[model samples]
Target: MNNQDDIILRTDNLTKRYGGVHALEEANFTLKKGEHVAIVGDNGAGKSTFVRQITGVEQPTSGDIFFEGKRVEFNSPLEAREAGIESVFQDLALCNDLDVPSNLFLGREELLFKFGPFSILDEKKMMRKAKEVLERTAIKIPNLSNHVGDMSGGQRQCVAISRSASFASKLIIMDEPTAALGVQETTQVENIIRGLKDQGVPLILISHNLRQVFNLVDKIWVFRRGRIVGEVIASETDGNEIVSMITGMQGGVHEKASYI
Candidate 1:
């Protein structure tokens, strides 16, 4: 059982709808501090929708979101970030033409000097901070001055993950973080995640890779047909059991399942 005081994020009866179709339904979920959890299911199973609502990419049709013991209604992703919730979507949202430091700072650039109506961007400061952030996350990018467009898929993914980790004070949400990477690159990203875990940072990972999910997270939340079918402790359950839960083959175990 998880202590209520340790809960960093909680959703009560969370639901989302579009016209006549329900994208998500009545989800009661809790994530504790420093805990890593995975959300997995087949396509159209509401995994992305649930994440969108939580990250403020979209509003819930009904229900409440509680973060760090306070009820929150995030009007935008910026608001969510201000509340210490950062997300790295599969799209990456980085400017390919920009350099590493620029991409890391993106919309939140720093200003160092001002003259009249003109202000100079703090490029050096941004680069220094970017290096610090990468080092802290144990992310290795051989060339920090190269354009992201020229980088490999895994490198780009690492930049996105690093950006999220740089400012995230509470939780980081990653959607298909390693879906497009090679084996070596995937290992690098996974190592970065492990570094986050070592630092006691909480994370929520959404992925179709059952192996990665089982290896990286402590708990698994199975979603099926817009609803969470089960929550299983990773150490206590196998991939087959999780697959069974996702397909609805196993019933009546969700309520009684023990989760950390």
Candidate 2:
């Protein structure tokens, strides 16, 4: 990555507090267009808060968020989505009872006006779009009408990812994307992530799985005590060092906690 180029998103003096608890503290972060960045930390280390601010799921008590070189304040996640930011949370926001295509095009449904002012959902068009989007990531769904509840964990995750890719124009943030999957399923989801990367959609991945983080992200940012402790390029660091930081054995400000 070059020091001089376009930046898609950045934060300055970002802070978030709940009552007296600081979830994020004066953290500065950046994401370059087409870059895949991973954030890892132990529980209560502010990973979720950081992503919440970035995705506009929660407002930062203080700080300015920049998107595509312009300062913007997002009041809600919908605002962020309108600005071309899509997120896949750990829950994936999937509808268990709905079919794959329905879940894929959930909120943003297509409307057809066969009668003026009395429009109905255009299911065929949405199904076609769903199939196309799923294919973009090489996700093989034998039937688009299958209920998501019946799909394998990996397939459900892929559907969620595909939905984000289908809607996101600039960035996608995924939180604990493969947390409940088996090894094979996790790899399937990782391949979908790689496909997203190849297509130039910058992604922010929030995961505690160091091995997955190392294998998928180009860079890793470590968080401790609601603050960013360090940022390391994947080529320059390993999971053991990051895990040590997460446990406070070693990092920006703590170096004596104990790695052994």
Candidate 3:
């Protein structure tokens, strides 16, 4: 087992409920420093619900979240981002009317005068920083002036990921990042994910594609009926075993993979 000091994120008995519906229950999860982990489950299996709690999109009914070894309860997604947890939700979250640079610095725009809403933005500086971020992630975009809504699906996805890569200091969480892209576009996004791994950034990916999960992450966590059913080392397990865990099929391995 990794030392406690090596843990980047952890949750203990995290639970969320709405009236009689329990969206997530007793989720105990962890991600080690520089490790990439995938969360896989079928629809309504509490995968996104778990992510919502971690990213501060919604508060849990009861739980504890530890980041960098410190307990925290973020009041909002903005607070989570400010605390160095960046997320690329399935929607991409880019403003349709904004150009590349503007969207890259959306909520955290670079201001010239530090005035509240009246301050003038340093467009040139923001563009330069955006370029550096894209270059570092090896993302190629032809024009910075193009509106995000006008770009291809893959390019827009890259923009969202680049925004996260630029600002995330501790960890990155991605939900269905390549769900709607074509083959080439999916490849592009996957390559960017690999780039993040190469940079030693810890990531928690929520995906349905077992192939992609095996390709990109070091470990997999399976969720079933609002609970984590199993955890496995990606290299030590196969898709069949993961599928059985997800579906709870008979004669399938349900035990956690040996980490030692």
Candidate 4:
């Protein structure tokens, strides 16, 4: 945990439930601006649910969410995005039939006057911006004209990450970012993540890869079932200790670790 001044996003007594089934049990979390935090948990834990609530995919049953310095409620993902919260879900939400530029600018496209009363998509402008975003992120792909269907898993993931990072001004939520990537591809994606970190993008990465989490994040938040159980600064703890906490061996150790 870092100092309170560094925290940019936080949830107080956040909770969610599905038809009387409590999916999240008053879980709390805090993220500092420009800080990289990893959320690690098992299958049944509320990591996904917690993320869903924060991103406006689902609403919390009871809680308070604060972004920047204002407390607010988001009714939809777009609302969350408008508030500078971007999420890269495990599905990666890329249209396979579309080209790199098309996928990058999906839903939000550039348009210019064509006929007297009608406008057409400005493909050239969108492609230029897409290329610029890719270059800025140091991402390499086959070509901007290449169809996403023809791309490898890692390439598609990079596009997804880049799309989120492009609009993300404060926070980026990544769920299982490297779940299906190969060795080389994982390295590439990891480098892209580091690049975002270098630019001071705050991230909440949900992963099962202990090595990746320990190596990249400034802090780790461990979740068990539906509650946040522990949080440890990456520099102050080892993977083994985190593993023990995740498996129920340790008890509320991180309660003392929350500085912000």
Give one clash count per candidate, in the order shown.
0, 0, 0, 0
User: Which tens-of-lDDT digit does each residue in 1-260 have in candidate 4?
Assistant: 55667788999999998998888998878898899999988787899999999999988999999888678799998899888898899999899999988887776678886564456889999999899888876767858898998988988999999898886568999999999999988998888889889999999999999889988999999998898999899999976678767777666455344221
Pairing residues by index, what is the TM-score of model 3? Answer: 0.94
Rate residue 151 of model 4 by lDDT.
87
**Pick by lDDT: which candidate is best?**
3
TM-score winner: 3
Candidate 4 off by > 4 Å: 1-5, 113-119, 250-260
If both were scored by lDDT, which would come out higher, candidate 1 or candidate 2?
1
Better lDDT candidate (3, 4): 3
Q: Which digits, one per residue and each the tens of the lDDT, describe model 1 over residues 120-199?
A: 79999998988898776665678789999999898899899999988856899999999889999999899989988988
Model 2: which residue pairs collide? none
Candidate 3's residue-wise lDDT over 1-260, tens digit each?
76999999999999999899988999999999999999998899999999989889999999899999999998999999999999999999999899999999988999888878899999999999998888876657899888889999988998999999888568999999999898988898898888888889999999988889999999999999999999899999887788888888855644553211
lDDT for 254 (candidate 1)? 60
Instruction: Give me candidate 2's TM-score against the actual structure.
Output: 0.90
The local lDDT score (0 to 100) that residue 195 gets in candidate 4 is: 85
Task: Quote model 4's TM-score.
Answer: 0.90
